[model samples]
Target: MNVLLQVADTAGAACVFLGAAICLLGVVGMLKLPDVLSRSHAATKPQSLGLLVVLAGVALRLHSVMDLATLALIGFFQLLTGPVASHLVARSAYRTGQVERGDLLFDDLDAQLTEPGQEEGQGRRDSP
Candidate 1:
C-alpha cells in the first residue's frame, strides 16, 4: 500500500474510534444527568461532535467522491439541526415544568418565558 493511503487509513480508524467513544460518553451523560436540561445538553454537544467525526471517518474510508459528498451532506445537516432540536426539546420541557429547579443555578429566561397563547403584557407566566 502507498504511504499516504496507509496514513489516511490509520487516521480514519482513529477518528472512528474517538467518535464512537464521544457518542458513548454522551449516552452515559444523558442517562446519569439529574434533569431534562442537562440531559439535553448531553445529547447535543458531544453527540453532534461525534456524528461529525464519524462522518469524516466514513468519508475517508469510502472510494467514491459521490459517497463522500453524501456523507458530508449528512454531517452538515446533523450539525445544523442537532442543537436546535435539543434546545427546542429542553425549552418545551422547562415550559411544561419537567426541569428540576434545584439544578438550575440561574434563570435569565424567567422574565421572558411565557406560556403559549398568552396575551401581551400578561407577565412572565399565565395563571393556571
Candidate 2:
C-alpha cells in the first residue's frame, strides 16, 4: 500500500510538471507563429491538452469525490470552449482580411462568402 501511494504521488508530480512544460511550449508557439490563424491554433490545442493533463494529475492526488468532480468539470469546460474560441478568432481574422487567402489550401469559407445572389452578411444571418 505504501509503495503504491508513493508511485501515484510520483506519477502525479510528473504529470503536473509535464503539463506545465507543454503549456509553456504552446505559449512559445503562439509568440513565434507569424499569423493569427496559426497563433490561435497554438493558443488552443496545446493549452487544452496541457490543462487536461494538469487536471488528471490533480485528480490523482485528490482523494475527495467533490475535488475530482470539480476537476472533471474544469476539464470539460476547457475542452468545450478552447477550440470554439480559437475558431472564432481565426474566423474573425479571416473576415477582417488578416489571414492570407492564398495561403489556405481549401477555401470553404471563401466559397460560402462569395456564393452568388448572397449579399454581404446575408448568408450569415441567424434570423429571418
Candidate 3:
C-alpha cells in the first residue's frame, strides 16, 4: 500500500509538470504563430489538453469523490468551451479580413460567406 501510494504521488507530480510544460508550449505557439487563426488554434488545443492533464493529475492525487467530480466538471467545461471560443475568434478574424486568404490552401467559409445562396454541393473554393 505504501509503495502504491508513492507511485501514485510520483505519477501525479510528473503529470502536473508535463501539463504545465504543455501549456507553456501553447503560449509560445501563440506568440510565434503568424496569424489570428493559427494563434487561436495554439490558444485552444494545447491549453485544453494541458488543463485536462492537470485535472487528471489532481484526480490521481485526490482520492475524494467530490473533489474528483469537481475536477471532472472543470475538464468538461474546458473541453466544451475552448473549441467554441476558438472558432468564434477565428470566424471573427476571417470576417474582419485579418486572415490572409492567400495563405490558406483551401477555404470552405469563402463560399458560405461570399455567396450564401450557393448550394452545399457546390463544394469549397481552392485559394489562389
Candidate 4:
C-alpha cells in the first residue's frame, strides 16, 4: 500500500512536469507563429492536452473519489469547450479575412467566397 502511494505520487509529479512542458511549448508556438489563425491553432491543442494531463496528475495524487470526479468533470468541460472556442475564433478570423490566405495550403472556404451570390468577406481591413 505504501509503495503504491509512492508510485502514484511519482507518476503525478511526472505528469505535471510533462503538462507544464507542453503548455510552455504552446505559448512559444503562439508567440512564434506568424498570424492569428496559426497562433489560434497552436494555442488550442496543447493547452487542452496540458490541462487534461495536469488534471490526470492531480486525480492520481488525490485520495477522494469526489475530488477525482471533480477533476474529470473539469477535464471533460475543457475538452468540450477548447476546440469549439478555437474554431469560433478561427472562423471569425477567416470570415473577416484576417487569415493570411497565401500561407494556407488549400481553402474550401475560399471557394465558397467566390460563389456568385456569396458576399465574399464583406469585412473591412483597418490598417494601423
Measured by TM-score, the strongest candidate is 2
Query: Could you estimate the TM-score for every candidate?
Result: 0.81, 0.93, 0.88, 0.86
Model 1 lDDT tens row, 15-110: 999999999999999999988888999999999999888888876778798998899899889989998999889877876789876678887655
* Reference-based lDDT, each prediction: 0.85, 0.90, 0.90, 0.88
Question: What CA RMSD would you report for each candidate?
Answer: 4.9, 1.6, 6.0, 6.2
TM-score of 2: 0.93
Residues 1-128 of candidate 2 have per-residue lDDT tens digits of 98988888888998999999999999999999999999999999999999989888877788899999999999999999999999999998988899999999999999888887787565565566
Write candidate 3's Cα lDDT for 7-44 as tens digits. 99889998999999999999999999989999999999
Residue lDDT tens for model 4, 1-128? 99999999999999999998999999999999989988998899999999888988888899999998899899999989989999999888988889988888989877766776547665334569
Question: What's model 4's lDDT at 28?
Answer: 98
Candidate 2, residue 118: lDDT = 80
Error of 3 at 34 (Å): 0.8
True lDDT of residue 93, candidate 1: 88
Candidate 2 Cα lDDT to native: 0.90
Give lDDT: candidate 4, residue 39: 91
Off by over 4 Å in 4: 121-128
For candidate 2, what's the RMSD? 1.6
